[model samples]
Target: MVKSAGYKMVGGNGVFFPILGFASIIAFIYLSFGDLLSVRYKNEINLSFVERNGTNFVVDGKLFYINGWNSYWFMDHAVHVDSRPRIRAMLQAAAKMGLTVCRSWAFNDGDYNALQITPGQFDENTFKALDYVIAEAREVGIRLLLSLVNNLDAYGGKTQYVKWAWTEGVGLSPSNDSFFYDPSIRIYFKNYVKTILTRKNTITGLQYRDDPTIFGWELINEPRCITDPSGDTLQDWIEELSAFIKTVDNKHLLTVGLEGFYGRKSPKRKTVNPEFWAADMGVDFIRNSAPSAIDFASVHIYPDQWFKRKSLKGKLKFVADWMHSHIEDAEQVLNKPVMFTEFGLSDLNKGFDPSQRDEFYKVVFDVIYESAKKKGGGGGSFAWQYLVEGMEEFNDDFGIVPWKRPEMYRIINQHTCRLAKIHGAYKPVTGNMNRICNGRW
Candidate 1:
């Protein structure tokens, strides 16, 4: 349930007057005196669990916009005592930049330091590391969006799940896609889900389902089933797992973590796809996201990877069109919010320049900002990834270390402040709200 943030004015003579007419005056006072209020009453106005309200997210009856970034390595780093500080640093940096959400992996299956050593077995030490991540993030007032698994092979993905099933002597199809169809594999995955949802955090002593620190649960990262281009295989998998997850823990939001490709069912929408082959990726943005248990839509943008042959200008155009199409579909067709869950321009591309990357980010941010201004289904985004300094081992072509990139940092900070203003929840930082709103921070 959403609580109202409305304020009232009472007179000494037992008379009352509506304060709605003086909104501008009240806003000025709040902004100017925010430092005083922040220390004393900020906790009183703190929002609880994020909730879906049509095409927007709300908390305490106020719109909650997502201006976030991904740090998939949080749990991986949190496991080591020395490296654990990095997770805290990253979250602190994100809070200073005004980011509200973080997307990271919750499942690391069958590998060194794996969260799940096998189908139902988990490492207690690794689970504690994840507990630390949640505890720290909560302190900074950031919510987490944790993915249950990965579609790719990195960090023990579907391949790991398939390998576990094979070792268990479950006679199944040789295809890795069987992870979605085979009954035994399905039960194994469900057991993992139930375990995660029911487990209590060691640090906070809060059951995973009851903690408002979690923004949502992503079923999988960039799920695709090329073996079944008809999309029925993936659609069925999403429906079943999404329903199962809801039954176990309905407090948090849930998304499919799709790359937002159009399939055979969306003939006209296919035109906006990056390539002809995208239509056969076995996951339709509309159909997969249409399940009753699925709360919103997820899309990932990687023009550099998708269209390696295109010039920078050509790639930028595709980025704009790709995002615009998905936003429109979310608003008009699905009537659900859509997040650009992952997007970045790789510096490794030939002839790549920081300027080019900046341009790409601007286009993506512009599309989201425009849609958000109109209260459309564009729910905001998380840049491909963020990293703290000295974490070079985890660095990829898309990794963003804000301190080292001043221009990119400014762009992200400006976007955060703009969205906060739109939500009417902007608070002054040390009584310098004007400076922050002007992007001077």
Candidate 2:
């Protein structure tokens, strides 16, 4: 039975009249596009993947820039009907701010409060929750970058996969790091890929695999094989898993999430950041992007994390150099489009102030815009997060809730407007791309 059946999302019309004007608009979008979703989505013409040609993202054969955010909590929060109004508000807020894409988690496989209860088993309620997220994003005209799994233990990621294997008597190493090499663990992960890829949304009646609103499928979120610093273990796993995903769903682009780490192969390149060598995650950016199925290269930067004791000025300079080196590598060596997929400074860091944070964002956004304008350096970026007013409890170091920090929101909106103008010059096949950003479309 479809759990989403007969359950109306809270931010819809008649029964739902929001106190906020944006909420009302969201209701209109939800009701207006209800059964005619596919037609409405196509009419908007925003459903194409931001494909890579040479070293830039092309949408409908024209250059596309990615001005987006990492809202990893959308699916997690939208599972409950009552909580959906918040999701609606956030997406509505993002649209208002001119964000073009969003990167979020598509997998929650683990034992403690897991989305997938066991291997080949899932909680239908949580699955329907994700269905609502995709449907709403389509309505709001924002594309998604959906990651399949997590490297960290926080959300039942690789560690949980290994635990499932151990319970089944696979008895691989006692370490979660072996998730990349263990055959049984790999099989379990592949099963998850097939399940999510083939899933038909309870709300839209479209297979997840066929949904063009999804910009791409990410194999994992920040994959690292710390146990094997040679980087071969992680590389082999990426090649095998990425190829497997293509077999399951050949439509969408695929990428491996790396932290712009330069591994041992090019010892000189590894010197780009001493922290890359010190962290010992064994990720070689050039070798990692060599797989045919991997369509684009991704990198994340956190100067605060890399140079914990550095002043704000030093951190900003590190960020500039970090971005330049990766952009150059993406152009010269990898010959693929590149994204500063993740980069942000946290408020919790020492010497943290609103002005400094704003400056940091400016420096990063400028790097991306400058690279993209030159037609090859950097494609786009997603700051650490986009949080809502009531979600302050989630405040780690990177959360940027627009209501609390209006200045940050202003900075983000400026980037959006600048990118929109640049996109207009590119003359995307969509024709009304400018109107799309201005919310007129």
Candidate 3:
């Protein structure tokens, strides 16, 4: 070896001296330029979980009222690499409108192309897309509520679980409705839950359980046990799943994505508005949300489908009353924070007037605000869905794109502003004490 700079002509140590000089130079360069190769994305780390304060949701010691949207398509579309920009645009637009939260689908099961391919199997690419979706939501200062499964069978829901049971030679009948009570079917669902809670997000490098941007987990979307109209099976399932999720991610809140069904327990409630009962869905809002493990309550409203025969005014009245009853029950009975997780009118339905839809939204938002103001009114709500300009096909008449429906957007924007103001202005009863005031113990 030839003598280099910093190498002295030592007796029989020329090679060692040159190697030491090169090692020192390499270390110096690494110390000076270490961060150049590593790109650090400036991600807003939101670590505050929404905690219940009586009829309110408190985030970071402040009352958190959800003025949000149900964007169930984000996970579905984001899985396709090319569809990411659209999601970014939607979140950006929503954040600009003063919307603070987004409820989106976190799991797609069954098919080979689904997020959870089959039971314990998951598609890494699809999951990474969800990671990006969560990261993007956090980047824009929006919180998320991720639903673990769906009631309907379109995107590998309970029906798929039943099919999985059939394939495994389980003795149970292959009816999707049995998903609530079937032990063999339940095992697969539990496995999926563990996967979601324990997996680390590839994009954010944070475990899903520890992410604060995630406001909570919905055990299942619009859960229903049609066979058992008494609501025992569904309620039992809610208790089990809610407890399991709490064990996995105690930091996040938990809710059952129920459709506000009164069930057969309260004949008066069921008969108040026969349509509200959703007898086919077979769930009791009170029973399902009463479990200690369930931190909050959720309900969806669809007057167009439920009351197809009623006039616009009649439908509006039913909606107002429906909200009033739910709020009262939540305040007096459940005492848990309840929200309208899904509500929107379809223009394609009978008496499809754009103005009626707008009016309906006004009624719902007004009721939500009024309820939130008192001890136990509706705390937050997510309209049926929000779509961008080009994604019109996703709109089954209920989806509202801000630019397309300027008037609806105006109403949504106004209510979002009003709700945000309410959330910002209200002080929590448990400020600094960190106690859940007025909440059910």
Candidate 4:
């Protein structure tokens, strides 16, 4: 999951072009045609919604691999006119880096600038803010994986839902985990899901359910039901909600945003968990993902947070094993594509080094690349969080500012180029194609 904070910004920078030399004329002609071809090529590809084809995402008859990031604050930033430019900058930078997907929060319930003011009530202005996000993302050809709700308390998550239930005198239990078992809360959530799906984007005049720019819908972010360690409660909730989502919007894909924790059913796999207590989180990755309504599997990695005592070297080794084990399971046992939706090493750790984070990113990317090369179930990955300059107030320990961190920027760009090449979707820009792919600015 991603940490949330606030931001404030307004103006954007300008782009300048130098005068062309004699040799530049020929290059200009070539690039002009390249741009035309690129536009036409993308149009054809975008005509079809991304679909899962036996462990691989297919778009217009070609395999699609994701290289993406998370900006959970997009909707928040887009809500205000003064801060709207930040959303554009973030998406523009993502496209320039060759990122294809972005996972962000689609729901912000009962908070400042909230989308859903009450269970069924919504703020039109806030909803339009999300419309702006989807519009801008479509303009840049970036797909969105919008999470419906959060498990953590940050953005009026399950806690807020339970609060609403209690306030209405229909809550099943005082515990926050009652969000999974309360029928009243369940109805409230399903209503919100339908509202979002049927919402027509004011900017593009397209309902979200019919928009291809949306990659899929995540049922919840990092779900955990501690009340029932047997995992049955969470399993039933997932089945009910997933089925409900599919009934409303069968065109798009769906996933249960699990942290890939092994549960009581998978006793042997529990050894690979970060700690013994992880298995009791009431989330069995395989069982939760096995529902017919769920399209793929989602996992998050945060070695820096999960195992603080381990040295950077130790964490790197664990990263390899953890990713490999999940990828193997998704391929063999589940026969579904698995995505590393969130992964990062925080700078706040004791004895932290930027090099360690860089290496951590490389390891995660390498594993995904290797799996993609073999046509395995490793779909792709999304780094924890992405922010731009002037958004320092919103920065968390895992936030990534590409311009400020050139090394990390290059690492991500190289991965995007390699993945683009694998799908034969690499489009030539006017200059420095080799440098861009080679990670040299």
Query: Candidate 4: which stretches are off by over 4 Å?
Result: 1-47, 426-441
lDDT, model 4, position 369: 91
Show model 3 residue runs off by greater than 4 Å: 1-40, 44-47, 276-280, 423-441
Query: Per-residue alpha-carbon lDDT of model 3 for 351-433, expressed as tens digits?
Result: 47788888998999999877656535478889877866555444556777754577987787677556545444332211211
TM-score of each: 0.87, 0.86, 0.84, 0.88
> Whose lDDT is greatest here?
4
List the pairs of residues colliding in candidate 4. none
Candidate 3 CA-lDDT value: 0.72
- How would you encode candidate 2's per-residue C-alpha lDDT over 293-387 as one tens digit per residue? 98888988777666756788888888888888888888998888888777777676656778988999999999988886677748889887776
User: Per-prediction count of colliding residue pairs?
Assistant: 0, 0, 2, 0
lDDT ranking from best candidate downward: 4, 1, 2, 3
Q: Write the per-residue lDDT of candidate 1 for residues 1-441, one digit (tens) a residue.
A: 000111111111211122222344344335533443333213232438888998888877777777889988888777877666577667766766778899998988886678999888999999999988987777667789999987766667787888888887893976778888889989999999999998899877788888888999999988889899999999999999999999999999999999888887787555788877788779899999999899999998888777757899999999899889988888888888999998887788888789888898889888888887898889989997787666554466777787568898888887877776665643422223355456433
Better of 2 and 3 by lDDT: 2
Alpha-carbon error at 380 in model 1, in Å?
Answer: 0.8
- Candidate 1: C-alpha RMSD to true structure equals 13.2
- In model 3, the worst 10-residue window by lDDT is 8-17
Comparing candidate 1 with candidate 2, which one achieves the higher TM-score? 1
Q: Summarize candidate 4's per-residue lDDT along 28-132 as a digit string, tens digits.
A: 324423342233222223445789998888887788888889998888777777667576667766766778789998988887778888899999998999998
Pairs of colliding residues, candidate 1: none
CA deviation > 4 Å runs, candidate 1: 1-47, 426-441
State each model's CA lDDT, in order.
0.79, 0.74, 0.72, 0.80
Indicate whether candidate 2 or candidate 4 has the larger lDDT. 4
